[model samples]
Target: LEWAGDEFPWVLEHHSNLEPETQTWHSKLVTENWDSPIIFTSMVQFLEVLFGGGSRGARRMHNIANSVLIFDEIQSLPVNCVHLFCNAIQFFVDHARSTTLLCTATQPLLDNLKFPDKGQLTLPDDRELVGNMTEVFEQFKRVEIKNLVRPKGWSEQKLIELMITQLKEKGNCLVIVNTKKWAKKLYDRCINSVDADSLFHLSTSLCPVHRKEVFNTVRQRLDDELPVLCISTQLIEAGVDVDFNSVIRFLAGLDSIAQAAGRCNRNGNLDMAQVYVVNPQDEAIDMLPDIKEGREKALRIFSEKDETELLDPEVMSLYFSYYFYERANLMSYPLTEKQAGRKDSLLSLLSDNHLNIGIEKNAIKLQQSFKTAGKAFKAIDSPTQAVIVPYGDKGKEIIAGLCADFEPAKAFKLLKEAQKYSVNVFPNVWRKLIDAEAVKPVQKGEGIYFLEERFYSENFGLSTEVVSKMDTKIS
Candidate 1:
């Protein structure tokens, strides 16, 4: 549903999960090559084409030249890939001639970003759209962020109770948790207090199509001023449109806190909205060091007794200064040398090999490790494989199509359609499902998988709980 009545020509730069050919000209693009005159794309897609070594993404790299690139939340840039991201951006601007724009309430100090290698986001003084950000930020004030994060973190019951309390003052409430497991746990508790119809659970466990369905229902319910409660992971923080009178966000980065505020009082019907920062006791972010560090910085801001607003531009600057200084060594995409048994990084391999360990005058091949760096690079730490879930009759039909005899054209169309019902599972979870025979590939060597119907939940969407419980039963 796009309306460009008298505006410029527009097309979304995306692969699967697109509309049919008849819907718009965007779908007719050949293999998502990103050749549109006016293109809208995700940050991940831009980064992939910028740094990724894949031929598919490289084919679209030239399209970014002489075009505009907007990074909605520039602060959300990965800590380790800071230098890689900046250096690539410099290349695009200086070499390819592209215009870059950043739109973030909590902009990170990219200029101060320094590593051993020379990859810094150095910008001129006249680059700022607004000279005085602190004053400008005050004008956009819509939500009051309240720091209620305790030392030991809020218990599951305490968070639910807080939501119940907010319901009295506000009609709709949103609880953003850190992990999907915690979201599901809190959602189960929320259903007991609110009606099952009004309670919604959102996470990566559900496919994009399923999430869209939930979004439509939630938005409609909010419009009617009906009592609505949604427990979601950080996925709903950005780019989601639905709003609530009160928002309870799990304590995270300052940028994340700013983003959560956008979901509250969005239309500004209320005088002022409130966003509560709550830390869950059961939350564990060991694999997520970036989030852990961001949470610690946010805790520092919480300890301040000043009357400054949560998204005060000055406060945001302090948070990033602390965060970047703490993670100074990781800005260069750190990696280890496989052969040299020494500390190295992906950026160094791609750059002018300053710490050359394996270079000899008579070397047969170059030790730049260009291919190694490309193969090693990953946008997301946890690489997930999409699994088709039985979300509805449409999902079932897509699964049937995937299992049918091989035909490239037909398979491509079916795969595109299946994107709606596909849930991306991490490697560990995928392995567990495979071990329990809860999932299997639809076509061998094709890499497309289908999950057993019992493993997919109407409430939880997808989980390994059924497989684990069945194993215990067998034992």
Candidate 2:
């Protein structure tokens, strides 16, 4: 739910009934509404409320009052504030306010922090949590990790050639890299090299609505066993669910490697689906702040201890333990600065489930909270224009006749193979389109795309420059 909140504006606006200003505010309301059995929110949203900055951040501070809050990608939290984040969770759990579960293949040594001189939540023994986590992973054999750490040899072309050969028979493949530019470059190369019916591209470059359309289409194609190929960044690595029969990852950190593996044969249907961990030559890590830090820590782990045992769960724990400790000092606990003075905020939030009951109670408290409506996002608005690219002479005529009232459903049907058009959206138009299934989400690697009716117009949002008219029309 919180994933959609963080990523999809439509989900956040409608489901949470939040205006633009209140989007981040709704993460707190997840537990207040308490409708679902599970909620997947980011580390920032979870920890921000505990630290308490403003009214919106404070809303969820009380929502997690009495429930299980699982922090996914716990290692991704900024380094200097690990003590502050962990201490907050400790307080909630220690006081019986909530059951806290930390989920990550790599566990940071959380005991390194010194909280207030008094009133800290005592944690469960680290040994037991680590043991249970390992056991759970072993039981779930959907993901199999293969470690291939070679210092040299292998160009991007060679990797793409190998993947095209493999994907021809496998039907679906995912290639994950470290950056958007590289993902785009690899996607273009794969599209040019591979003999596939459909090629998809995904990255964080596409807004959330655009990304969702691409993801949904790729997922449907995979389920139908259709020929599809994608290249993307690590955005799809963690919680995004479409599994490919094969996955190729450019190596960096052990945790990321594990996440890349999770996207392969995730249902455990194939007896032996392959996950290749290769080192990309000419790969730039300077743009990747977390990856750079994680790689440095992983190198230290490999050199001083456990060379053969690298990426092993135990080895990963130590790797993150060192990584977070160093990272925390770099940022100097920017989000956790309030930890010193606001001892009572945590205490008051944890004080009572008496506030948990009654819709009236929640309604009254929410009313008392500040209200902030959202600004209109230009990417999403009504009556937004789309482009019709005529790849050939015939395609040009088909697009030239387009009018505002022309049938969108039929116009989309004609542009299937021609130079494709870019569909633009008005505020909330995408939410309507998605609900009506007028537009479908297609996922390639980590980039999302959609196919919708082609409209002819010179004006558009940021998508205008991307639209090109093709010389030929299917008609």
lDDT winner: 1
Off by over 4 Å in 2: 1-41, 48-54, 112-121, 125-154, 169-171, 207-210, 299-311, 325-328, 331-465, 469-475
lDDT score of model 2? 0.53
Q: Write the per-residue lDDT of candidate 2 for residues 210-312, one digit (tens) a residue.
A: 4566788788888888877778888787678888998877776767777777788888779767777677678787846778777666557657764335545
Error of 2 at 33 (Å): 11
Q: Model-by-model lDDT, in order?
A: 0.75, 0.53
Model 1 quality (TM-score): 0.86
Could you tell me the lDDT of residue 82 within candidate 1? Answer: 86
Name the regions of candidate 1 deviating beyond 4 angstroms: 1-42, 52-54, 115-117, 124-132, 305-307, 337-341, 359-367, 465-475
- Judge candidate 1 against the unseen true structure and give its global Cα lDDT, from 0 to 1: 0.75
